[model samples]
Every structure is written in structure tokens, then in C-alpha cells.
Target: MNNDFKNNAIRGPINAFMFKVLSGYMDRLFGKSKRQLFRNHPETVVEIGSGTGANMRYLKPGTTLIAIEPNIHMHANLKKSADKYGINLEIKAIKGELIDLADNSCDFVVSTLVLCTVKSPEQCVKQIKRILKPSGTFIFIEHVKAQKNSILRWIQNIMHKPWHWFFEGCHTNRDTKQVLELAGFSSLKLVSYNLYSPFIPIVSQIRGRAIK
Candidate 1:
């Protein structure tokens, strides 16, 4: 196992359990948007940070889903969900910053709420672009920083440390939108919205696709 993977063993299981428990509620909050964005995804798609396979429900049965998940603890539940969904699941115990795919080898890549947790959002997005076939799209839904000078922003700043610690390095105020825009995609389309959930630190969210 990678050192990073081993180091996270203690917190990894706790995070995995939390995601498993909250998967249904999260789906309820983001299901519609996920369905809209995931519609007609290719037969084989790559998904970054596929925790507990929460997005599996949005994919068609028999779809080939290559899940990039670094946390070993999430794999068991993720596999269970894949079986339930009839997906052809391939698990890669790797981080998004260093994907092991060939250049232009993938047609589509998907991510949901992953950017905030990656060690380097820029490197992750770069890897996404590198592996995508020309004109291929990277679909994503990520929580971002609340507007500057807003009360919510203040709360995000205050809660940042604890949130990061509890969530295994998830940033409470990551500027994911900016990272995508600067990734040099051929074209990008994004929508910003608030998820009216109790998780206020992650309420400000964005979802869209960037074409390579």
C-alpha cells in the first residue's frame, strides 16, 4: 500500500462509514443534478474519488465504471454498491493527482465532491485533462468557497480546520471553479447553486462539464 493510504487507515474507516451512512441523504440532495449531468455517459467512464459508490445509482446497469479511490476502507462498500447496481467495477487505489491512465485514452471522466479533498486540485484537474480523449468531457460536482465578504464565508473560514481534520483533508473553502477554468479545457460550462443541506460549510456547490 502507498504510505498515504497506510497513514489514513484510522480516519479512513471512519470517513467510509460516514459516507455509507449518509449516501442516501446525499443522493436525495444531489440526485437530480447528478442524473441530469450523468445522462448518456459512455459505456466506460472514469470516476475520481468514488466514495462508497454514491453515484452508482445514476449510472445504467452494466456500465463499466473505473473508480479511482485512494481510501482502501471505502472499497468494500463501494464494491457492494457496484454489485447492487450491476456495474462492471474496476477499483484503482490511487489519488487523482497521479492517475495511471494513458494520454487521450479515456472518453469521459466524472467527479463528485472530490476536488476539495485532493492534495493538489490543480494537479488533479491536469491529470483529468491529460487522460481524456480529444473533445472528451470531464463532468463534476464540487463544493466551493462561499462568496467573499459573506457571512457564510466567515463561517467557512472559522470551521475550516475542524472540517478538514474530520473529513480527512477536505477543504471547506476550495476554489474548485477557478481550478477548472484555468485547466485550459477547450470549453467549459458550469452552474453554481446552493445545496440546502445541514452541511453549511459545503452548501455552496458547482456542477458542470469541461470538454478537453
Candidate 2:
């Protein structure tokens, strides 16, 4: 693991509790999208940068689920959470840019609130594409840069520096939608949107399926 992945969490108890609360909300929300995207069809679903397995419940047990999480600190929680559900969790301390999974092996690929912090977003998407089988859906729920009221962009840019420093690669202003297109993800169907993040005017909730 790298130094960035081994950094200690300085999050306060209150902050930690809030993180869990928000995460639980995402799990519950994504469940519907995940179910609708697959229509209850069981398939191999792999999630890149699965932080602490917070979204595990959204995945069906019959679906083959695998995860790649480079952060060692998050893996502890990932394991604990996986055990709680008796889920088959294959976690690795490997970067999303450097995933080591077989190409075209997964029926679907997933990501959640992860792209904002990954080092090589393009490479990660390319790797994800390679691993997904034909017509494999890439389910995701991420906060993206806003289009209206340049106010969001201004705020994001102003707070970007300290944000990245403290959060280890997080960029509040990452143009996630553009990046996804650049990575060749054209099959997109946005499901929802939100405007409240720790510090951002526009946060997006999206659903996209890769056209393999």
C-alpha cells in the first residue's frame, strides 16, 4: 500500500457518524437503481474503489460481487461490513488505476462516490470497460460538477486546494460527466441529483451502463 492509503483518519466521532448516515442513505437509494438496471437478473457485479463496503446491501447475494479498494484503512471497515452480511467480499489494496481483474469477466461494473479521488480516472474507466462483458451495465452514484449558476464552480475552485490536501486526492471540482464521456461511457441515464455535499453547490446522482 502507498502512504496515501495508510494515512490515519482524523475524522471526529460526530463527523464519522455523519459519514455513516450519508452512506446508509446512498445504499438505500442506489438499491432501487441497481435493481431497476438489472431488473433482478443475477450477474457478476464488480465495484472499483469500494470504500469500506458501505454500499454492500444494494448488491444481491446471488450476484457475484468483487471489489477493489486501495485504501488499507477503509479495508478494515470493508471486511467488518462484509462479515456482517456474510457476503463474499474479495477486497484488495490496489488502486483503481491498477486493478488486476480479468478482462471481460464481469457482467456489470459499479462505482460510487469514488471517481472524484482516484489518481487516473481515464485509466480506471478503461480498465473497467475491459473487465465488463458485452452489454454490461456500469452502475454509479457520484457527485459531479454543476452546469447552472457558475456559483458551484467558483466555490469548488476556491476550496479545491485544501480539500485535496486533507482528503487524499479528492477534487471537489472534478468534471465527472465530461470525464465519463472521455472514457467512452456514452450509454448514460442520469437518475437523480442533489446539491448538498460537504462543500459544493451541485452534487449529481447518475446511472450509466457501458456499451461493450
Candidate 3:
């Protein structure tokens, strides 16, 4: 499988279908906690890579949401989901690296399962930091590189290229936590956990907030 197949075959229809099936479970597992992290209702919220608007349902009342989704194929569903959920959303069909917002414009930035696939993760973070208010918050949930010397770690290394090709440029082993911290977040907080399965062992995960 190549990048084309990954985007057309896997990322479009299949990815949307899979999300439809798994979103409820995902919400139950992690979405609630993420919502709690933003309970204070930021006036301006920007969710990068808001695929199908899964996070739309979690937005707090009176928040003005900017949903950035680079893929055109996902836009319709994203709009439908936002409308269905009654969210105050503005859709932007653009990449995270070129966020069409002014400096210090947004109060909160969010990314969930998105950093791994962005063309330049560091650039995305830099843009986020640029647009965020001085006291703004950046919240993220990402699957990352496994523990050193572990079987899963070795597997991730071995499958790196193939996995990227199969999953629309998603790297299985990015050190995204460190990337965010290095991107100049003022106060950073993150925690790691694992989701082990027969097919994929020790799938490492991280979720937290970085205050700018």
C-alpha cells in the first residue's frame, strides 16, 4: 500500500466507517476526560484535524469553534456532525501548518489522533503556539513510540515505513510529547498509558494539556 491508497482506500471511506463504529467507544474511554479539561468554556476554540467532527459533541456552551480539516472528503460528514450536535462551528478546509488565524487569536487549541499524520508536527505546534492567547491551552491525545527495549518498540521501528504508507503518513513511533514541549509550551502536563491487543502490543498513548 502506498500513500495514494492509504488516503483514498483507507483514509476516506474505510476510515470514516471505522470511526462511525468506534467513536462511541472512544468517547467513553477518553473523550469525557478531554471535555473535562476544557470545562471552563474557552471563548475561542480551535480543533486541528477535526475529522468528522467527533469532538463537536464535547464542546462547551457558547464556545466559538474553528474546525480545521485538510481532507476535502471529510468535510461533509464534519459539517453534518457539527449540525447534528448543535455546535457553534466554523469549518476551515486547510492544513494545521497554515492556520488562517491571527497571532494570539484563539484561547484553546486541540488535536486528537492527528499529530502523527501532519506533514510537519513541529510546524503545526509552532502555529498553534503562535495563534494561542498567552494563557491559552493546548490539549492533545496521541499514540506515540513505545517503551525502549520493548517488543512493541522494536515492532514500531520495523514497521515504520510500511505503516506510514499504509496509514496516510501516520508514523507509529513519534516522540510527540517532547515535540510539544520543545515547541515552547509554557507549562506542560502529560501522562502515558498502554493499550495492548493481540494484533498490536503495548500501543502507547499520551494525553494532556500545554499552557502557552
TM for every model, in the order presented, reads 0.96, 0.81, 0.88
Q: After superposing candidate 1, which stretches have Cα over 4 Å from the reference? A: 1-7
lDDT for predicted candidate 3 compared with the true structure: 0.77
List clashing residue pairs in candidate 3: none
TM-score of 3: 0.88
lDDT of 3 at 55: 81
RMSD of 3: 2.9
lDDT of 1 by residue, 1-212 (tens): 13263238688898899999999899889999999999999999899999899999999999999999988899999999999999999999888888999999999999998899888899999999999999998999999999999888898999999988778788899899999989999999999988868999998999999999
Model 2 per-residue lDDT tens digits across residues 16-47: 34445577665555566655665554556688
TM-score of candidate 1 relative to the true fold:
0.96
lDDT of 3 by residue, 81-186 (tens): 8677777778887778888899998888989888888878899899999998998889888888888898888998888888776556778888887897688778
Compute the lDDT for candidate 1. Answer: 0.90
* Alpha carbon lDDT at 4, candidate 3: 47
What TM-score does structure 2 among the candidates reach?
Answer: 0.81
| lDDT minimum window of 10 residues, candidate 2 | 11-20
lDDT of each: 0.90, 0.66, 0.77
Q: For each candidate, C-alpha RMSD in Å? A: 1.7, 3.4, 2.9
